[model samples]
Target: MATLLHIDSSVFPGETSSSRSVTDAFRKAWGEQHPEGRVIYRDLAADPVPHITATAHLAGLAPASERTPEQSAALAARVELIEELEQADAVLIGAPMYNYSIPSTLKTWLDNVILAGRTSGETPSAQGTPVVVVASRGGSYAPGTPREGFEFVQNYLEAVLKGSLGLEPEFIVPELTMAPRVPAMSELVPLYHASRERAFVEAATKAKDLAERLAV
Candidate 1:
């Protein structure tokens, strides 16, 4: 059976979070396509992973037999996360922009999984795995937008997920998410709704497409 690794890093819960809502849509569509498929979910806000430490970092470079007791424990934690990625047929991430970047919890997860000569390097263990990223933001940061240069969530993920790990990444962005909440941006509420609707459609369509591809 197919397995999906879903990670949500939104601080908000349920439908209150735009990224979470969209990711939920994608997951629902995926479930419909593969009723028997397995899903491994991680809610970073509720249960965040430990940040990489000096011991953990160094342990990755050392042989298993040579690691100290402390290093062995730290490395074991990282290995668990890495093994999840390697075992997954696909990955889904809710990476809402926080201060023009991804959440610290998500970054911590990446740091743990990305080990040199293993999950990364010339032949990554999870290479070619398809990863769908739901990158919702409060404002517009697309090309030609005023704050385009300030966009770091997708850019950083692209570098780490695709460039380093060799994963196939496809993004579904829902921008201007703060339009309805922020008074000053009230005029853009319509645009925000449009973007959100498009994101939902894309999420469902992409989920089905991926399911079909995996089934084949």
Candidate 2:
């Protein structure tokens, strides 16, 4: 059975996050398809990933084969992130856009997951992990939309997931411009619920396609 890791980084669980709704849909379908599969979940919004401190970076930068005790320990935590990834055949990441980019917590978790000589080496062929990134926003960012400037999150994530990590990370974005849902804060609750429903449907379809391809 395939191992699936569902990583969600959304600040709003009660109100419903666009990204969170999608990721959960993906996980549910994936589980149904692979009934015997092992699944693990990490909610960064609830228990955030640690920020990479300067000291941690200093330690992490040391040669993997020559890490000192402290360096080894620091890098060890990062290794756990990668091991979880490596052991899994598929990964599902859900993150809401923050200031037109991925949340800092998600970014921090990625810093730990995409390590050298594991997710990728100095060489490109060595990198073959596949990732699925689901993003949500309060606005639209379709190719020709006026809010296309908000695409920085998708662009940055694709670059880092593929370029830095040397892996292919497919992006599934469901944009729900708030205008339709709410005229003002008073309508936000209703809009939030509507967005979640839409997000779940879209994500279920996208996830099935991705899971089938990856599982094969």
Candidate 3:
């Protein structure tokens, strides 16, 4: 059975978060399709990732014997994270578009887990299993609408994952805002926010369905 890696980076829990809820839907669908498959969840909210520093960064390429004690220890934790990502057959990401971009926490984790050499480095082509990126945005960012800014998050993510990490990203699907918002939407502003969240669920359902069929 395939081993799926579910990474959730949203600060809000349950229905409060558009991104997390959408990701949860994908996970649920995946679970239904592959009951026996293992799903390893990494919650960046509860267990925050460790920050990378200059010494720690250099230590990753150094031979074990040549590294300082602190550098070696720090590198160990980071290497393990990369290993976990590489081992997974599939991956699901929950990202919320903040200021027309991805969250900072997700970027931090990406910087750490997506390493060179082991993941890409010598690899001739961008080779790896594709992961789904599901996001929710308050403002409308559809193809032809106004305020449709192409943020660097999706573009940068695809490049790095495909080039450096050797991890192929399947899609950059963002459920965005539009006309009438959603139910339980208190004020107009809140409703606008909630609508974006609802779109996340809708988009995630489609991505999950596609993935399940492909996996089978």
Score each candidate by Cα lDDT. 0.97, 0.74, 0.70
Native-to-model Cα distance after best TM-score fit, residue 77 in candidate 3, in Å: 0.9
Pairs that collide, model 2: none
lDDT (10s digit) by residue, model 1, range 1-216: 999999999999999999999999999999999899999999999999998999999999999899999999999999999999999999999999999999999999999999999999999999999999999999999999999999999999999999989999999999999999899999999999999999999999999999999989
C-alpha positional error of residue 68 in candidate 3 after TM-score superposition, expressed in Å: 1.4
lDDT of 1: 0.97
Predicted structure 1, TM vs. truth: 0.99
lDDT minimum window of 10 residues, candidate 1: 31-40
TM-score of each prediction = 0.99, 0.83, 0.80
Give me the runs in candidate 1 sitting further than 4 Å from their true place: none
Q: Give the range where candidate 3 is weakest over 10 consecutive residues by summed lDDT.
A: 177-186
lDDT winner: 1
Output the lDDT of residue 111, model 1: 94
Compared with the true structure, model 2 gives a TM-score of: 0.83
Which tens-of-lDDT digit does each residue in 47-111 have in candidate 2?
98788765567666677677677777777777777778777677788867888888888899987
Residue 181's lDDT within candidate 1 is 89
Tens digits of per-residue lDDT, candidate 3, 1-216, equal 877888888788877776777687777777877789888888888786887777768887787789999988888888777777877777888877777677778888877775556566886222576678776666556668676666556676778777677776765454443223554323456556456555555655755665666577
